[model samples]
Target: MSKSYKKHPYLKESSQHTKYGKKFANRKVRKSEETLQHKDYKKQYCSWEISEYKFYMSEQEVINEFFASRNEEYHWMKKFKTLKEALTWWKKTYLRK
Candidate 1:
C-alpha cells in the first residue's frame, strides 16, 4: 500500500502571494513608514523634512531636534508644561517665519 500525503498551505515550495499581494507590498512598504498625510503634517507643522528621504518622526523626536537646532536661542521651550505647548511655541517662533 502507498502512503497518501497532503501539502500544507503555509509550507508551499513557492510563495503563495498573488500579483495583488506583491503589488500592495511593494507600493506600501517604505523606509520611513509614514503616510503621505502624516509626512505633510510633520513637515509643515513640526518643521520636519519634506524631502524624498524623510524618516518617521514622533513628538519626542521633534522636541529633541528642536533643542539640538535652537541650542541656547530657544532654551525657554524647556519650561513649557507639555510637549504640545513647546511644539506650538516652536512652530510659531521658528517654523512659521
Candidate 2:
C-alpha cells in the first residue's frame, strides 16, 4: 500500500563515527614521567589515628585555636607507616608519666 514507502525506504548509511581519544580522561597527558615515578616511590603511606579526649589540656591543644575559638574541644592524631613507629609516637605524646 501507500504506507509502505513511509515506513522503510532503501537509503544509504546515515552517519559514521570516525573519532579518536576515547579514554582521554583516564590518560595523563604529561611530557615527563621519570621524575613522577621516583616521587611516587619515595612517598610515605602513613596511617593516622585520632583520639578524642574528655577535656582539653594546656599543652595538648589544637594548633588552630584562634580560628575556631568557640569549639574548644580537640583531638590529637599521629601518623606512622608502621605499628612500631605509631606506638612510639603515642607513648611520647600521651603516656609520658
Highest lDDT model number: 1
- By summed lDDT, the worst window of 10 consecutive residues in model 2 runs over 45-54
Q: Pairs clashing in candidate 2?
A: none
Query: Relative to the unseen true structure, what is the Cα RMSD of model 2?
Result: 28.7
Report residue 82 deviation for candidate 1 (angstroms): 0.4
Q: List the candidates' TM-scores in order.
A: 0.24, 0.20
Q: Give the clashing pairs for model 1.
A: none
After superposition, the stretches of candidate 2 with alpha carbons farther than 4 Å from their true spots are 1-78
Clashing residue pairs in all predictions, respectively, total 0, 0
Please list the C-alpha lDDT of all candidates, in the order they appear. Answer: 0.46, 0.33
Q: Which stretches of candidate 1 lie over 4 Å from their true place?
A: 1-62, 65-75
Q: For residues 1-97, write the lDDT of model 1, one tens digit per residue.
A: 6533332211112234334444433444443456656445334232221122223334476688656655565564557756677777644433432
